[model samples]
Target: MYRMYDVVIVGGGPSGATLARLIDQSKSVLIIEKTDEKSISKLCGGLIAPDAQRMLGKFGLFLPKKVLVDPQMFYVESYDLETKNKQRYQRFYLNINRKDFDNWLLKLVDRNVSISRNTKYLSHEYSGDSITIQIEKNGKRDFVESKILVGADGSQSQVRRKTFNDFRYITKYISIQSEIVGGVILPCYEVYFDRGLTDFYGWTIPKNGTNIIGIALQGKDAREKYERYLKNVLGNNFQEVSRRSTVIIRPRRLNDHKTDKDNRVFLIGEAAGFISPSSAEGLSYAFRSAEALAASINSGKNTGKDYRKRSLRIKFNLFMKNIKSIFMYTKFLRNLIFKLGIRKL
Candidate 1:
């Protein structure tokens, strides 16, 4: 007989774990993760906003003391115009070690969640009402039937690759994040702004003497732009300790869930393009999506639109649009000032 579950979640990241924790105890849920007992290594600059904190708190998720408020936020300077004496502004934000925050999120998951590690999904055969999955574990293969499947995998999502064409969207983020043990001494979370980092931002978040300095470039030639920003932030004498590059994806439509076909499998978090297009922040969106997924499942609404309405997708959709529009304005105002000679050329 085929093994069965009400829901089967792939990936044990924040999105998946959060989703599992929120599912009603009455529902039998199973999770498949490829990593070991300790979880896999992740590269990120973990920072949570007020709303994100509140959402996590509601679910009993809390960070360590080290995740304290070091920098509320900061903005270094934006390339408002092509001028010698360009004025730049600063904004402050809190930063935390990526590993610690990730671990904390995993800990908060309710014990009842049956999270299986060192397991992999070979393939899936989808029928009208349910799906059949070929799962691998400890050199053994098993077949499981699940009514609902959630894909919380990151950018390179297998679920997305096999299941949906609609998840495709404009690639807007190109970022380089690094941890430098020795760099120019900076205490605040400073973000340097420029046309390259337009829409996205650059940040120097404190990691206890070491710094997480990087740029989120959304324009053409982002690699060179990102490199230049890294040099400027770290200074010539600075030595590299760590580095990573990432491409961020955003869903096409911001808030309208009218397009969701549902079809048994749900794409949550990065799989669903929940990352804020402007900030490239998705942790909160992931958990919120999980919550929405939970509510939608409880209500017995099986389509994507109903899921979207249940998920915080609508609220976040508005937030994403507003932020994107604001950044566009910032770009526009700067360009207009230079064109009108209001600022130096």
Candidate 2:
């Protein structure tokens, strides 16, 4: 007999794990995670917003002090490479260690929730009111059937590709982050905006003991831009550090849920392109999307329709932010906007 699950969630990030925790315990749910360790390393700034704190509180998931690095009233310093001008703005956010934060969320999941680590979703096929999914583990293949399939597997989700092959997604930006060693500590976050350096933005976020320097751009020469930005920031005293790069996706349409001929499937987190267009923030969106997805299922509604409705506010905000970002492409407008000191985040 084939193994069975009422719901199968691919990817064990904030979205996947939270969805599992919100699911009814009586349901036979399975989470397929690619990482073997709970606290897997990830490339992110790991800043939690004030709104995120309330969201976590609603779920009864309180982040311990250990998971948080430090709380600070952060000032964002924006640099214009074209005119060599700098402007400062303040925004309060809590910095955290991505590894520890993820581990904390993972621990909150009920022990009854079945989690298969070191597992990768291969492919899936619909058959007789169920979907048969193929997964790989330890060089071995296994099969499982699920009534509802969820693709929470990041931007480049294998589950989304295999299940929602026709989902229109645009790869908008490429982000590269490097761990800085023996770097000077700064009291606030820094951002660099230069069309020549990158079309998007370059940021330096202070961590517990070190700093994370990264850049997001819209062209094919991401590595070159990243290196140039690093050199510009560090001058001749720049040192080599470990770096990682990943693609950021943006859905062409947020309200549409046409993924081939399947409606029993759902996509959340980066798989559905819930990232912010301006800030490149996804953690908050991931958590919120997971909550929306879980609530829809528990209420006996169409997951896709419910998710589309639930994400309207987020999509609208992203759309407006993208419009605002257009002004940032031009140096004059960007400088003016910074000079005006608009507090809206």
Cα lDDT tens digits for candidate 1, 24-105: 8888888888776465356666666555777767877556785464554554333332232234344334566555665566
Give lDDT: candidate 1, residue 24.
84
Which stretches of model 1 miss by more than 4 angstroms? 37-40, 66-94, 137-142, 166-168, 196-199, 218-222, 252-262, 301-305, 312-316, 319-323, 326-330, 334-345
Residue pairs clashing in model 2 are none
Error of 1 at 23 (Å): 0.8
Native RMSD of candidate 1 (Å): 4.6
Top candidate, metric lDDT: 2
Model 2 scores worst on lDDT over the 10 consecutive residues at 252-261
lDDT of 2 by residue, 1-345 (tens): 688888999988898999999987888889998886654477777888656777777877767888877545467777887778787766777788888787778778889888998988999888899999999999999999999889888878787777656444464677888888654536678888888876678888877666788888766777787778887786655455678887766544444222212657888877777776667777877888888888777877776677667867767766776786678666778877777876554
